[model samples]
Target: MKLGRHSPAPKRQKCDHWSPCPPGNFAYRILSGGGKERTATICFEDEQLVGEPGSGINIAIVNYKTGEFSSTNFFHMWAHDHSKQMMDFIRSAPKGTLLLMATQDDGSTRLKDYAKELVENLGSKEIKNIKFRSSWVFIAAKGFNLPDNIQREKINHSDQTKNRYKGWPAEIQIEGCIPRNLM
Candidate 1:
């Protein structure tokens, strides 16, 4: 995968102690209309899970219209494991659903794979109206990272919702990461 000029390089933050550290926080600057006036809280305490330093991955998704959010933790499991549940939820979503896919700096590749599969399956006509729009998120973590190439590959493979529909306007926030503020 080609790393677009806009792609972010690997980043990390150091902690002074080994004690349970707080999860990081993430916010997205959303562009609407002619100006960027909206900011959404992508990660909150309710969306995080605590485990051994590096035991699992936390994934979160938010409904743009209702600001409703849903999250899950994947531990020693493949993204495909959640296919059924994820598909069910997406199918029920109204048109113009913006699904955001986020992950810990380390889980980026895995999450991207999951996103790719979702787009492929949804686009194949096996499902209807359940289209994957676009995904955006910041990758932050203390250690372990996804190579820039893999990240780009996944993003490119996933279809952007905007390009797929005319003027459908629904945003679904999908986030995957360990909240820096949640320990």
Candidate 2:
């Protein structure tokens, strides 16, 4: 019989990243909703800030300097007049705040043009392209800009012919290390 020593498993980094983040950096992960059973989630600094399955949008706010989360909210846009409210919530974020957003179901059904513009201002390039039940996730900074190299936004559209689940698209996720706010 051959005897071999067992090795310990590698430690998991924040947000289950492939590797540990560099010093003075924050780790984050954002996942868009898939089918009815899979919900969207947002994680930062090793904590799950938001996770819920429903129609509309999920939002989380985090303090950039302290690496602390402040709030989580959901806005139902499919059949509600909540676009203005959501826009206000986004505008309320203060400087140095990190905004994480994900869509659970139909995020663009009732989304207005102004709201899309606001998301665009936050560096989102795919907001205008979201369709019915499209899976989308985004991370944006309020006052500063995230490095261009960092992964900040991702989207997957629901196509009947190529849907991963019945009437829904496959889930999409973005995970990476964001440098700590130095300014």
Candidate 3:
């Protein structure tokens, strides 16, 4: 009986999640790169912390307790020897920090084994399998452990026979609600 423009349809959860997270949880979304148009993206608690197009690795650090981002940075792994620096950055994150990573283009050409090993310590099972132009995304907690049921990582490799783009693979994405009480 009362309405000019209907109250905008019930707002969707952050990052367009299909459903709202429970009261004590936060939502997040991670999208990997795919060609020139599809770049990488990272969303935490309904806020986009990183979404730039380039060729390398994108990283975001979040304070688990505060629910705020502490830093956002990327490395050019395709054309530069930034693996050492990337490793150093990862090592610096303290306990209770949430680390999110996504690939924009080629993330393994310049990535050394040391860097991959470091990521593995954080529970990434696919870091070693990444190949040229592979789309990858990962989330890990520095000190605490994420629930085993949560989706922690994903990857898509560029296959000449079935790539979505002429020279790039299709993008991959992962979204989930993380419990805020994670210690």
Tell me, by lDDT, which candidate is best: 3
| Candidate 1, 1-183: lDDT as tens digits | 977677564443321122332444333321111101222223332332222122112333444333344433332123434444544554454442233333221222223455446544433221122223222232221122222322111222133335333332223232222332221
Candidate 2 displacement at residue 47 in angstroms:
0.8
Off by over 4 Å in 3: 1-10
Better of 2 and 3 by TM-score: 2
lDDT of 2 by residue, 31-96 (tens): 988888899999999999887565688999999989999888888888876888888999988999
Give the range where candidate 2 is weakest over 10 consecutive residues by summed lDDT.
157-166
Residue pairs clashing in model 2 are none
Candidate 1 global TM-score: 0.28
- What RMSD does each model have against the real structure? 17.5, 1.5, 3.0
Clashes of each: 16, 0, 0
Error of 2 at 124 (Å): 0.8
Model 3 — TM-score against the truth? 0.92
User: Cα deviation of 61 in candidate 3 (Å)?
Assistant: 0.3
Error of 1 at 128 (Å): 21
Highest TM-score model number: 2
